[model samples]
Target: MLQSFMNVFTTLGDTVVVPIVIFIVALCLRVKARTALMSGLLVGVGLTGFGWIINAFTPVVTKIVRQMVSTTGINLPVVDTGWQTSALVSFHSTVGITFFIVGLILEIVLFLIGYTKVFFATNLWMNWGFMIWGTLAYFVTKNFWLSLGLSIFMMLYVLLTAEVQADRYSSYYKINNGTVGAAHNMENVVPAIILDPLWNLLHFDRVHLTPDALKEKLGILGEPTFIGGVLGIIIGILGNIRRLGTLDAWGQILGFGVKLAAVMTIFPLVAHLFGQAFKPLTDEITERYSKGDTKGLSEEENIKSKKRWFLAVDDGLGYGEPATIISGTILIPIVILLAFILPGNKTLPVVDLVSIPFMVESIIAVTHGNILKTIANAIVWFSLGLYMCSYIAPIYTHAVAQYGVALPAGAVLIASFNVMCRPLNGLIFLAWISGNPLWIGLTIIVYAAFQVFLRTRRQQIWMYLKKMSDRNIAPTSNSNMASEIKKQMIKS
Candidate 1:
């Protein structure tokens, strides 16, 4: 779309607009004149400089990397090596990705905007758990050097933003619950996990606990009571900055920018540093398993065992891993079958249509809960609404007929049912993660459906559960209890 505009403008006009808009927004919203101007200037300079430096330097970096690889007889899984690739990766990783990620996270704060602490207290933990897990996973795969840079940048950012947020929230009569605040929970677990590898490596293993261990040890923040208190204070402070009147908005925003820049600069460095840490972590972790460290093992062994579970679940379910598995196992073969058996030019794969929701849930499940989760979930519903809102049975039937496939319309419908229901499952998950009524409603729907399925097959799900090994009965039972309570009320 922008490409078309570039041709129409016959100049670099598109590039010209963002900075100008950013500056103007900063200037207008800023309470203080001096801070506004400075913020405006910084935004303009920083963004422009970033674009230019990336354009000029990316090629050099790529060439140097490529040459280094060739000389050392190394082969890196680089997507086509060119200036464009380098620039794209740089822009995406540093600016685009960071802004989007932070923006998504920031949206959660908006949920707190006119609400009291008591109302959002539970929601906050859910949000934290999701962020922690997502951030930890991101860091694990992300460059350690990049994370180091991000950590230093984030530490400062957290501190500064904490002050600003505290001040902002305070303006609205929000009280800081001192340094000690909420404990880490499942909501932010994903972010914590995403940030874990990078943070662990950056701090020289200060948070030695694996992402899973951390989650189990520190369900929400994965830190001590002191750390949670400190974090809450920081967030409280950042939230409070809005209380300082409009004049401070510019400074607060500027501070945030500095923090973001620090992240941009440092993440690449962190990525470079911990590029190989994943290997050693894997090795040490695997060695423990081979040593037969089961539950109730020695501390190190138990720790390793816990780490393994966290790593497995986080990685497997994180990053749409579950959906990928499902698609590979179920969708792909369906698509292939249709392609080969169907008569006419292959119509859209039925599996393709159905797979969309599974993928959506996978992504949403991993994203830190906040306004982002709400917005993303809304989008998912919109998509499902489009598909199921109408009797699109003909669409499915026609597609199937066009192909010579023998799959019945009923089978296609079932497949569609599976996919459509998947998104609703996401809603239950959302409620569960949020620890709210939303989860309860969705759980009812899921349990009802499960009961219907059980009546037909009678024993598949139970049989499947029974076949599993190395289980955590208490937690599993609790989850099942939640499901059963939901089931009894709305049995299908």
Candidate 2:
């Protein structure tokens, strides 16, 4: 009886079932069937496109790098095809780290100086180091030390360049007023859109005064080390004054640590238990099938046996009903409640939890009009979902690893769960999902420097969109609510 029920539940969660559920939900929400179908089709096409792009670009980058190595005698290692080229991959090195730090500091300094003009400039630098470094690193070297060193150099170059630009005056701002801007914004579409059109864009007049300006403004501060120390001391002093230097913070920290441990330790154990409990169901069928006990059962029994096999496997995942409810209803509510009761006025954790899913849903909800737009947004959402998985899954896996729990062979696990999800989410959001090659790609290289220094998603998104809009990169769409409804009705 238990085996039969487990089988039924497993069947309900299949690949086919999930899409059906998505379709049903979309329909119930008044998302037209055609719109949903198109969106689904687009997701498939985008994934296919992604694969082809990777297959094509990997070789091209490899060929170019090899030639460059041959000519320049850089002695860089050959590219490793095995490593993923996600934002997280880019962030895991010394250079990537340094680049982000410098960009972040510069952003704060510029903000202090009331220089909102630097937002685009900063994003470009940070994005370059992070966005380009990862994909380029794969082609350049395999050694961790070499990669780290090079990444740092790249970050340094970007920082110095920003320093130069910050001190200089602009003759003209990049004009992103309409559809023309949208084409330029498309990553690598034309490759040479003259992002700045000579005199107006170059700030040649400002170049002469940049050194003098840098000296007058930032030279007094001197080296980065001094600035870091000053900031640390300020934080330390504030901590001491507030009496939040130790035990007060420790409890929350420890509680999160415990929660992480539960995810890491408890989840897999439950999975294992479910597996063992259902083993008999599998073994009996396997035994009968292998031994050819055909006379014992009818055609319906045979169908039931296959169905049982599917269910037994699915139900053993252990994250079925309990985890779903915990995540969707209970866990989220508890997190919010805790945020309310446990301390600070800042809803950092709650906001982070809410933001990522919210962003994904919002993007999808907005794209419910056109076919390609809907599909593109869905692919983006899927990509975002993977990022969320990367974020939370690691925390649980790391917790287990820290406690020295040995996982089953071939089981992928996370190393640490960042309970402070908002900042981390913002980092992942900017560096990975938002600027994915499919979304913005190398344009990010132009925009990333602006992004690395900021800590908040709200601020980061605001800065990023403003930069795009100011530069006339974000294309303006002309759809309103009534039009959207009419379009949906036409599609259905």
Q: Which is the leading candidate under TM-score?
A: 1
**TM-score of every model versus the real structure:** 0.23, 0.22
TM-score of 2: 0.22
Model 2: per-residue Cα lDDT over 250-298, one tens digit each: 4433433343333323433443443342233323433543465433564
Superposed model 1: Cα runs more than 4 Å off: 1-15, 27-35, 72-492
Instruction: Return the lDDT, model 1, position 484.
Output: 96
Model 2 local distance difference test score: 0.31
Model 1: per-residue Cα lDDT over 1-492, one tens digit each: 433433443243323443344334334433244443443344344334444544443343233223322333322111121112112222223322343235333533532352111122211112221222222223233443333222222222222222212211211111111110111112122232243244334442332222233445666553223232333233223433435466554454344334423423432333222222222332333355345445345423332232222111111111122222222222222332332343332122222322232233222222211112323233333334323312333332333233232443323321232222223323332343343455445555655564355335323422332221112112434667899999998986
Clashes of each: 86, 27
Residue 423 in candidate 1, Cα distance off native in Å = 20
> CA shift at 187, candidate 2, in angstroms?
16
The 10 consecutive residues of candidate 1 with the worst lDDT sum are: 176-185
Model 2 stretches astray by more than 4 angstroms: 1-25, 76-468, 471-492
